[model samples]
Target: MISRISALIAAVACAATLAVSPLVAHAQDQQASAASAAPAEQTAAPVAEAAAPAAAAATEKKDNPYSLGNIIAHGNTVDQAVLVILAIMSMGSWYILFIRLWDTAKLNKEAKEVRASFFKKASLQEGLKSLSETGAFRYIAQTGVDASEHHEGALTENIDHNTWVTMNIDRAVGEVNSRLQGGLGFLATVGSTSPFIGLFGTVWGILQALTQIGVAGQASIDKVAGPVGAALIMTAIGLAVAVPAVLGYNWLVNRNKAVMSQVRAFAADLHGVLMGNRKVAGR
Candidate 1:
């Protein structure tokens, strides 16, 4: 009887153990799934965060208020006209600067050639031939020669050969100088006036801005900043146009002085040759 009672207790305990084991295994599986999903959730969070900045950048690009397009679009007719005038002035200044630079370079090159070959020639005719036909030195030499040869003309008879030759040489030098100085005035004008023109634009822009502010009855940064910035851009443009023009003008003027010195020296030597003081050949 004791053995049968023991056997019945063992069977009941085994059934209970079998039922609890399955529940414990299911709980373990659920915990394992949750642990694996947590890492994936954390990794996905960083990806979402990185994408947000790119979206914001796109939004900012679309709303840029200070771009040139916005300036032109919001500007008045007079403001646009001022910009146009500034552009035209800038264009003219650059054109003159480049053209003058090219002319100066050409003249300097011709001057060098004259120094190297002209004085080495056997006679005045040979020297003239050696020089570039379009050169200022050749022109001055020809003028002096003509004055010496044509001293008998009624218009020139009152002047002695020396005075006549000097006058002709001086006149020729003046002509060359005038040609070299052709665009300098325009450059000066642009440099002096561009800033004022820009200031005019600024004034006009500010007046308009003020008018709008008065109408809007508000002084917020958003309302005042855009127009004010656009107006200031005119001043900046003017200065941009002026500074280069001024610099180019000064540079060209200095270079002109150097080139003219060479020219005057050539004219003086030619004058001496015409006066029979300096022989063309070494003999």
Candidate 2:
């Protein structure tokens, strides 16, 4: 009976060990699967982090409607007209600036040529020949010569030779000054008024924005700020248009003064030449 009981206990212990081995193997398999999944999760976390910011940026760009392209595309008729006027004013201002700058440069170049070539000649007739046909210097020289030669004319018979020639030469210088002053008024107008034009656009935009916001009854920051902010861009653009025009106007005015001074000096020298056989100052 004791031997039979010992055999039965051995059989039960073997069955328990067999059941426990499968559970241990299953636990180890699960632990290995978890370890592999952890590495994959670590790699995926960095990729997800990078993708999140990119997705956010795309959403922001999609939501925002204040880009220049959008302003032009989605703008109302008044907004479009204001933009057009500002554009035209800006373009016209630059065009006038460039053209006036070119004119100033030509005047300066002619002044130099007069000093080098016209003043070096021995006689007034030879000096006149040295100047350009269309140049300010030649015009002055011809006016003085014509006045000296035609002293008997009804317009100038009462005036003496010296006085008549001087008057003609001075008038020529004044004409040159008038020519130099051309287009400067436009620049002044643009500079003084462009900011107001832009402000007009901004104010109109604000009015529209407010009207819409009032009708919608959505006074929240997101709703109010976006349209108002977009409206302010018109003011910025107006200022941008105005600043260069103002600066260019000032610069051209100063340069014009310098040019006119040189012209007056040349006129004085020419007057002396007509009256006497005086040597030109620079030569």
Candidate 3:
């Protein structure tokens, strides 16, 4: 009975060891899997973080073309003088553009109405009266009519017909052209100067950046980007101001030229009409 009991107890202990061995093997396998997975997860975490910044940066880049905010972010690099010049150019250009546009439209409309009325009736007095109601074109129209009327009367004052006609036509054209060209000189000046002003600002900024780079003892993208970027803003802003002004200046100049041409033509036609009327009345 004692021998049987000893064998049975040994068998029970062997069974317990066998069961614990599988558990230890499973735990080792789990720990190894965890160790291997931890590096992948750690690597993946950094990749995800890196990708987030790239996506965000791409999104930001897509939103703005000029990215004025970026230029402003590095504001300290820009000179105050450059900023002031840019502001003045921008405001001045826009103001001239709007004012000149309005003037051109108004002049064209009034000239059209006057041309239609004058051609329809051929009454100089009626045309002048109709023109005066509009307030602006009356100056041009009245100058033409008054000069023609004066010359018509001067024909009786022993003045030569051709000389009197030529002199009054010259006076009328001069006055009309002068009024048409008013304030246009300033627009041209501003358009021509704005780009150079912006260039000066850019050069100033670059000089400042170089000076800083010399002091920093290292010339890297980080050190050079701010001042260079700020300098470029001035150049861009200058162009922004100059391009429209130049375009507007040219456009207004052409429009005024056209209107003035029409006025001169009208003056010539009026001179002929008046001369014909005087000769007809005399006959």
Q: Select the stronger candidate by TM-score from 1 and 2.
A: 1
Query: Which 10 consecutive positions of candidate 1 have the poorest summed lDDT?
Result: 274-283
Q: What is the lDDT of candidate 3?
A: 0.73
Query: For each candidate, what TM-score against the reference?
Result: 0.75, 0.73, 0.64
Task: Show pairs that collide, candidate 1.
Answer: none
Error of 2 at 112 (Å): 1.7
Provide the overall lDDT of each model, using Cα atoms, as 2-decimal numbers.
0.86, 0.86, 0.73
Q: Count the backbone clashes (under 3 Å) in each candidate.
A: 0, 0, 0
- Candidate 2: list runs displaced more than 4 Å: 1-64, 277-283
- lDDT string for model 3 (1-283, tens) is 9999999999999999999999999999999999999999999999999999999988784533234565554355445656676777678767767876776677678778767786677576766677756445565456545554565454455777655665666676686577667667767777788788888878887987798899998898777776777678778888888787778878878888887777767767767776776788789
- In model 2, the number of clashes is 0
TM-score of candidate 2 against the unseen true structure:
0.73
**Root-mean-square deviation of every model:** 5.4, 7.1, 7.0
* Local accuracy of candidate 1 as per-residue lDDT tens digits, 197-272: 9999888878877887898899877777777887888889999999999999999999999999999998988887
- Steric clash pairs (candidate 3): none
How far out, in Å, is residue 279 in model 3?
Answer: 1.8
